[model samples]
Target: MSTQTPTVRGDAYLIVDDHALIREGIVRVFSDTRPQARLFEACNLQQAIQTLQGEHGPSIDTVLLDLNLPDSRGLETLQRIKAVAPDIVVGVVSGTDDDHLAMQCLQQGAAAFVPKHGELDQFVQGISAMACGGIYFPRELLWQVTGRLSAADAPPMVPGVASVRLTQRQGEVLRLLLKGLSNQVISNELGISPETVKLHVSALLRAHKVSSRVHLILACASPHAA
Candidate 1:
């Protein structure tokens, strides 16, 4: 297994992929963006786990996981890591162009789903967003999911928020929220006043019983969500 040992220190991002080139490229991008950031490398799931269990383990907050590792594949690998360290922020790095699979990974608790072949900015954005407790739904996947959910004919709400049902307008507002749009932007898009948009958002938050917009987004974007 190939590995690069960095003595610089800051946030810890463990790149778990079987390919040395893939892991190295990601490390380069990270080093350029945050020079002081310490990056760890693992060629497979087992090595990845060992890296996490080592001395600097607790300091590690972000994990960049490749779905097609030698020891595992698909969302199962993500599930295993989360099972071991629920606190770790895992952002999936997939070569697959499957939106459904990417969405599934997000639902399975990945903080972000980055297409391996996508722009370098997107990969950085995914890791950066996840590091800050934000979900980085890839632009391609986001556009698709937003278009799909904009129809407002979604499935039933999941168990925890089963009682919360968003009206059509509320659903639109929710979709905008997931897109990270500001109230003014949403209002402009919906051709409604900002106050009206705020009203709907407040109602949605109350119905979902979330104290903040972030929680609301997480609840809705979850796999078991409405």
Candidate 2:
């Protein structure tokens, strides 16, 4: 068999999950679609931390975070990673279909939210959109959040929000980032390359005029807060 060469790109990504199979599957997908994308793997939070905190740490552009790891659990997992690296984009993944909890994550700081059972195409679309300066959210959840806002009540522009005009996809990515998923997870869940996720994140930062992911999360989560 012929050997496959890795793609070279400006972006780099990390995958943090406990399952070897899942990690392998994700790597394969990225390798196939984004040959230039570089991928890193961590079996647990500690390993993830080591890779992220190393001398070459700045090269990482995005992360794929799992909620249930051997060393971390629940939202704490997301919180800790954000604390460690505020600039890197993150996407959250879980086995259960818990939209409310997922929304809570968005409110906190995840780039995207995806269920394990979601269709592969939807997942890929979500990741691709996020990579291309867009966002992705579950259709049901998007409706749930925006359904209460009347068209008249909705402004031509969201008040006091002049920096970034959120494309639907960017909004989706912002929502999930607030929720705390890592870039690799977002890529796998959305079936896209991690580098794409990084592109959207950079666009988001520029649009928001925010210096870091922490500020982006705060702005998105506390729209009413002064």
Candidate 3:
């Protein structure tokens, strides 16, 4: 039930975890990176929902949530956060490192899925991606999923294909994506609107025959991919 009121002008972050240590660690890292950023803390799903519904809710730009809260578990935690603050970026920071769970989080609208075992730098990267309206998965998870898909001997259209066609702008978008830029960042980089960037991203995914941005990046990383 404790919170740190953020300033009116900078980005606000909500850290939803029952563990005091985890919350403090995230707060410390985020403060190091974004000194002026606002932070809020919650112990469980109910507290989190309450904070999101409170006066500071609209100011929250991102939410770093732990999946295994005392009152909520698994994807339901993410779904509830999205239900209350659909526009706010939500990133999962779970102790579990399973790729299946990571994929599920992505499918369920998480902007990032980071395992608790990862280093702080990697965690920060995930947060950064989510903050900018982009999706991020751990590199190990990405490689694992890519390998699994590769082992399936996927159809030629699914990532390992030669020369998936792309418009000049799509190519620009792809290049930025490879660099791990989010839609908002890509839009700023390409001088296009975020909605336009989303369209190009969707086109890239379609061209690669993959469903998510993480998969699109994986496809682009393949040797046979363009």
* Error of model 3, residue 189, in angstroms: 12
Top lDDT model:
3
- 1-226 in candidate 1: lDDT tens per residue? 3244433334777889898888877877676656666677888998888877766567678888998889998888999999878877788888865768866776677766777776777666665554444465667656654554554356533224656566667777778777655687688899999999989888877887776555665565555653
* Residues forming the 10-long window of minimal summed lDDT in candidate 1: 1-10
The better candidate by TM-score, 2 or 3, is 3
For all the candidates, what are their Cα RMSDs to the real structure?
6.8, 8.0, 6.0
Model 1 ranges with Cα > 4 A deviation: 1-10, 118-121, 124-133, 148-207, 210-226
- Model 3, range 142-218, lDDT digits (tens) per residue? 66544534432333233455565455676667667755677878888889999998888787777777887666655
Compute the lDDT for candidate 1: 0.71
Residues 81-195 of candidate 2: C-alpha lDDT, one tens digit per residue = 9899986778776665586777777766887765655687766655554444344566665544444222444432322465436565565565555444566676766676889
Candidates by TM-score, descending order: 3, 1, 2
The TM-score of predicted model 1 comes to 0.64
Could you tell which candidate, 1 or 2, scores higher by TM-score?
1
lDDT for residue 147 in candidate 1, whole number 0-100? 50
